[model samples]
Target chain A: MKYSKQEYLDYVDKKSPDSPIWKNVLIAFLVGGAICTIGQGFSEFYKNVVGLSEENVKTAVPITMVFLGALFTGLDLYNKLAKHAGAGTLVPITGFANAIVSPAMEFKREGWVLGLAAKMFTIAGPVLVYGINSSIIVGLIYYLIQKL
Target chain B: MNKKLGKQTIRFANGINILSYASIAGQKEGEGPLAKYYDKVLEDAEWGEDTWEKTESKMQKSAVSRAVEKAEIDIKDIEYLFAGDLLNQCISSTFGLRDFGVPFLGVYGACSTMAETLGLASSMIDGGFANTAVAVTSSHFCTAERQYRFPLEYGGQRPPTAQWTVTGSGSMVLTRQGNGPYITHFTAGKIIDAGVADANNMGAAMAPAAADTLATHFRDTEKIPQDYDLILTGDLGKVGKSIAIDLLAEEGFDMSENYNDCGCMVFDIDKQDMHAGGSGCGCGAITLCGYIMDMFRAEKIKNLLFVGTGALLSPTSTMQGESIPCVAHAIAISAKGE
Candidate 1:
């Protein structure tokens, strides 16, 4: 009895257990909201206590968050948190910091140059590339519209 | 003296015995249900090594030494050694066993390496090519994770189908001489692709191959599932095991009884938070060497069918959207050589 590719896929899909989408969404929402709240707290601290300008406060908040992310990754706690948090940790700027620091730390055994520096951007490199290119295209369209 | 049985099965005319076996497990595995069965469980994943790859090599080294020591044979007496691991270029096996100075043959059947090595080693002994040989395989959780998935500290969620790779190693000493629990038949499996492209869902990718090999083994040996006291597949976990059972049932073989998977047995799935169950080359190797061997020695199981299953897909292949190609190899071991 031979099963075609589609038949086999359908059978596997039916047999295999699916992830709990509703539960995951709920967790991700709560945790992601909590992280954003923390970021807001940092923004308030920088603006009021530190007496920083609006733009500088925005920059300081993200830097602090990235720092916390890298520190947690180094302490080996972010992955543990992200395990249950799911997209909660990933949707934040902290996730980007983890994406960079993790490979760097993991491959550090190879060497400082080839291992840590070269592979640091493996995950986040694509995000940067596409993000910057898309922004430039948008800026060019805005400039053309203004000229017209 | 034709040893060929059916299309894929080989009947050993001369007795091929498992003289001794050993298992070394990691901390997580040590905390599992089969903890007491393992020869030694390391508290550290690194095993005092600088890297995870080195730790895996150390595990293979320890496993082989323990097996050889239990067999009461010197390393020099062993004519051939078969070993492998789930590392690129099989560096763990090569680096681990290099110091022994034995005739080494490195094999790669993905996670099915244990069965592949055993089948080859036993065949070598039965064919009079070697009087004594050893089969060993190892897999490290960290090493496998870094190579196959993401970095250790990378924050990502695994789906329900993802299996935790077992951090362990197992080795078996096979010789032409022993009293019982001899390898009677070997059935090599074909590469079966069931169009599963998800690397995380390894059980689904490998189930069809396992089912095909098991069915072929039964057909070639002309033995029913009732003939064996136990039928075990390597690292099918919960998902693949059920799929395999259903596939076999469709082919008129009822595997609802006497059929379990090493993946499910090696770890306490519910308690350990191992989504699907244990996987990797070590999953089958340790289960067979540690728990199942004790069962054999105690005469609890007279007949056993061990099938090692493997999903042959690399990260590159998965990235290319290619389906996983899987294989399974079955070896029939009987206490009375029946």
Candidate 2:
């Protein structure tokens, strides 16, 4: 119970779950590539079929992916797919949508206010707070430089 | 009047009889090898409750009432109830037995709650404070996850050192007289902290406490591991069990032959992929009240030592990067004179 630091580190290393490196890499590659292809398809559809400009197409694609991710999560389909897809389900913007929806759904039983609404930001909360705050700081710096 | 031995052991002159017991497990626990030991296994995790906390309360209530029923005693005759859970305010026990009409004593030893409750209940009976008492504890996977670590929906990766909290409740009745395993000795544990801060690795955090308690119990009683048919720890899982073995060996005691962990025994580690195996307040409680009781009834074991280990850390404390403080309480039960 009272092992040295090196022994403790060894114990952790030995107990660590074995991950099949090549197999995981293959799955990640195939899955991640497939998600990107779908995004490209959406962009093409918006540009050609809907006649959207490149700027609008860029905006529409991420919105569509996030919607689909939330819908899949609601249907309880994303987690199942994530099992096989691994990092594939997690690498895309849809994964970000899933990060919000999953915890929200899990806490729904605690009631809408304290449970779902409060927990909706469990995973994405930090990202949003830092991302927005840093952008505001950067905008200030840019304006100050222009004035100088 | 005093049975205290050395620093920890308490020998009950008029051994307390374990009247009866009951265990209730969730779907995942039911699927494990010890399914048959449980009195009831819920097919759904919610157990018809709106939240996991409510479900845990429901389980404790069921386990206690069924244990009393099995003892064939009138509900009004039960004098005291000792129960707890891995929840804030020990809400599971408070809300679960709100209608039992029995005087309640809420205790907390984290995963070691069962042993602590049993030790206290046995002392109460042996001290003539109560003729009949019940010890019950419950833990649910979902409830403990959100409370101790993270939201169930986080889908965070668990390391191999991590243990799955058993979603179950186990209850036992202790009476002054009965035909069951007799509580012969109880050894209280000292709070031991080895400065381990990682919450995920509970086995490591609790192992030193377990080793210290076991060594103290042995020294106080002037006995060794071989004296008992079995020596079981509450929920050390695979990793902590090995560490305990090494630590005991350092003290010139070898426990390889009879030592086992409730965590590893509750679930098939390889098959269930439970990593380091099960850990929770209910993990040891159910295994002892359910599996070990069945073994005792079958006369396969004459005596045993049960040490319930617990990592006493709250989410707030862990979030603030405080080290996990741990404890292990030991109880000696015998069937030799029965």
Candidate 3:
């Protein structure tokens, strides 16, 4: 009636907090740092390649992380780390990337255009919506404040 | 049956009081009742700073103490005990209760033990056999770790969608023609195989059992999902819960609203910080014996159906490449009267 391994895994995740280990701590720093670096690179690339502005790239960093996260998540690489580090992959700025990539990957099998593309944003759709909404408000406020 | 014509001669059903219960009283011994039996694997079992004996004994006895306190019954008064655990001999439950000195009935129904014990005790009362009996089951981390996974000291990663094994225990007292809680009906699920063999992903592995039991429960009882205020399953986590919604929808039932899984419900996500969910007999048992009973006693929920799902496929069975055969036993725990 109960899944032992599954349940035990849950217990491990819950009861044991983050273990202080040099290997994992360093791994978190490196991987997290690498992801951030990639985000900066992507933002610059998008601005240069797609003719988007710096501001657009700034916004795109989060969007990029969300996409990359989903991609890695789908590949199960992020899930592996998420399982081991518990909060490592989950706590990163790239967690949004894993989130988006995972769901998109999950649905990608339904087909690229219809399934993958449509659901690519499923997990992060709320974040996207909130991002867009808040951006509009923030931009308006910033412009008004600066002009005044 | 509709002979309510003369007088509303309606009195609650004569129920049984569970006299005593037992569990693995874990400690620093690093061994449970079944420890000797697990000699081969004991060397491999590991725990964190918290030893298996510690968590298990602490959990098992805590429940024993709580049950004694709540029931207001002295330990010696308990007439019988029906108990089990994940261990070979159900040590944490059996050995822990050794001092309680109640007549014991050992049962191994995997995660369906709560129902198994309750079912056994209920039948004893219904058949006019025994009046007082206790049903208990417990699982400790150290003991379970050695048996199932690498030693905690080994430090290995777990899979996604994995739920923590509950190391706690719960005991209930069932007395004959009693004034307290009574088990109304029992509906057991058939041994169902959906051909899921992955042991790591138990949520998917146990999904069919949960769905099938839910289906069978609805089929056998002629009760809709809406009939009960809460339709609870033993240990299907978020993944299985999603699948259940889709499965139930095929039968024109939607459990999206009043539906909660014991695995998902037992712990506070933020508080316990559990990722996917919880597992083991205690997951559902404690939830029922602890949380649900309190709500039921307070008249918060009038009628409830608890369907505890268990993956009958063991390590040996699964290692034999057998698809998980899951079974769920459904029991109706209602208020004093409907």
Query: Against the true structure, whose TM-score is highest?
Result: 1
Q: Is candidate 1 or candidate 3 better by lDDT?
A: 1
Instruction: Please list the residue runs of candidate 3 whose C-alpha ends up more than 4 Å from where it truly belongs after superposition.
Output: A1-148, B1-58, B270-273
TM-score of each: 0.99, 0.93, 0.61
| Model no. 1, DockQ | 0.85
Tens digits of lDDT, candidate 3, B166-237: 555667777775555566666655676666666655666666667767776676556788988888887777
lDDT per residue as tens, model 3, A1-148: 2335556345334433344567666766776676668877888789888988877877887877776675666565766665555445656666766655554554544588986688667556887799899999999999999999
| Tens digits of lDDT, candidate 1, B1-338 | 78998899999876698899999999999999999999999998898999999999999999999999999999999999999999999999999999999999999999999999999998999888999999999999999988888999999999999999999999999989888679899899999988999998999999999999999999998989989999999999999999999999999999988999999999999999999999999999999999999999999998999999999999899989999999999988888775
Predicted structure with the largest lDDT when compared to the true one:
1
Estimate, for each residue in B232-294, the C-alpha lDDT of model 2 and write its tens digit. Answer: 999999988988888899888889999999999889888988989999998998899899999
Docking class of 2: acceptable
Looking at model 3, give its docking quality level: incorrect
TM-score of 3: 0.61
Q: Residue A77 of candidate 3: its Cα lDDT?
A: 71
Q: For residue B36, what is the lDDT in candidate 3?
A: 25
Model 2 ranges with Cα > 4 A deviation: A1-30, A80-88, A137-148
C-alpha lDDT of all candidate models, in order:
0.94, 0.88, 0.63
Q: Rank the candidates by lDDT, best first.
A: 1, 2, 3
Question: DockQ: which candidate is best?
Answer: 1
